[model samples]
Target: MTENRRFLLRRRPDGDPVRDDFELVSAPVPSPPPGGFVMRNHYCSIDPAMRGWMDDEPSYMPPIALDDPVRATTVGVVHASDNDDYAVGQWVMGLNAIEEYSVVTPGHFTAPVDVEAVDSPTRFLTAMGAVSLTAYFGMTDVAKPKAGETLCVTGAAGAVGSVVGQIGKIHGCRVIGIAGGAEKCRRLTEDYSFDVAIDYRGKDIEELRAEIAQAAPDGLDMVFENVGSPIMEAEVFNLATHARIVLCGLISEYNAEERVGLRNLWQLIVHQATIHGFLIADYAPRFPEGGAKIMEWVREGKLRIDEDVQEGIENSYDTFMRLFSGANEGKQILKLP
Candidate 1:
């Protein structure tokens, strides 16, 4: 029997998750049934959403059950198959576990990948996976930015944030990005085509507000929010009339023991702004439309994709921690041989 190493949830975390929250175990690989296939995982994505899944609270998706294999998205190659549609040696992406192998039914997943067209096999989890889709739908469908509008995106150097800012520019909006450091801020403006980028690491609230005013003199028409809490409180002060705020991931509060409250909520009512919190899964039905458009833009050199990959499944927890510290510049993934 083939042995598979998998990470199991040891306990739900109170603050930032540590390696102790997960336990690695070795188990026998399950044999594929009549219509199932076995996959050897190549890459697995580590997202901030996983933090929300740890809590047993109401969310777009169900919480990860205690003692269950840590839930994640993975790309793997079919090693054995009983399903006619999924032949051996084909590469596929699915909602799998942080494991060495998986036994999946064809119906519960997506079609196999065409590796030749993508820049890397891991791109399936980055540009072509849920990250890109979240940026596409959240910006285009939810925010609905128009020409000459001022667009502001928080977590501006992250996987989804970088794409969000670029798409804003493509639609003729003046894009401003808020990140954690000068290096990230520089990359957003110089490399990602954002009109202005602000570093929020050392800046006081007043300085941040002034920076926003300078970058977006007309105020912000669309705000793609990825970080919540203190930063979001500042964003509320800069919103223009009728502005649309697309609430994506809230990485800032993921590690907090107590929920951080926003102080400037009155700005929302006074500015007539709309704050819409969304999960990409809600728009899964329209994923193909968003994916095709993003892919087309990538092919035409209109969009840029960035990835920070850490080798081996054992490092998954540490790589995930990078998101909170701004150590990763883009979509963070773990490679499993």
Candidate 2:
């Protein structure tokens, strides 16, 4: 534990990231500087957004620099502290890196989390974490689901999309989830209570659009989009008048060498719909407000969040690839030994 192991970004990726794109290195355990603290990371969050961050492009956050540990959100405990406000052994979660240890300062992304307030520290990366907050604000504030209206969710089986569909149901909206494979589609209805589940696997854009049209014959009043491009284009073909589209994430294009542009944007103009880009960082100040409400639903058995936990730093690459491969069942996490 004395040596800090880090998964460093060796180079920027061209298409899908390869193992050579990152290098695992061991360095001396770092000590906290003035007004800072050192945290021993227990779990690293594996999200699709990490792929986007690796590319040298404009984004909400800076691209991961070459030779630096890949940026990620981690839940851990204070191993050492130089800050008066943070004490050793306190549980915290923050936008850190894929390393055994992290030097942290109290700021927008680094803060103490109450372990007693939740079931487990890993839950901070799932249910009561940024994933849930993204779903909450996207539905409650942006899309604004209304009773009896149809809500179409792309990537509906994912961490954010699953929560979004459930939130839609809570508001009395009919939920239609579009996911890959039969199992994921089944889970949309049986597990998440989505009214209809459309399997987009092995289907062309028109084929997928036809299914969406059948599932939501009245046209979709709201769309919670996670996977972009073709899936989003398919959703657009079935929009109701004044439909709202929440652009949460575009996992499909994140790893593409060349990003795909939508051909169905004219549907938005025809329907007089609106598409709003959403970033969770913009809602940092209201995290407590959203987290509390999500926790309330979770405690009351109205919400369910799943986690796919893998062990060891060596498995980080494969674990992370699950986000793009559709192999992960829920919120992908890499647990540090």
Question: Best lDDT goes to which candidate?
Answer: 2
Looking at candidate 2, the ten consecutive residues that score lowest on lDDT are 255-264
Query: What are the TM-scores, per candidate, against the unseen true structure?
Result: 0.96, 0.99
Q: Candidate 2: global Cα-lDDT? A: 0.92
Global lDDT of each candidate: 0.87, 0.92
Alpha carbon lDDT at 170, candidate 2? 89
Q: Which regions of candidate 2 fall more than 4 Å away from where they truly are?
A: none
Candidate 1 residue 153 Cα shift, in angstroms, is 0.4
Winning model by TM-score = 2
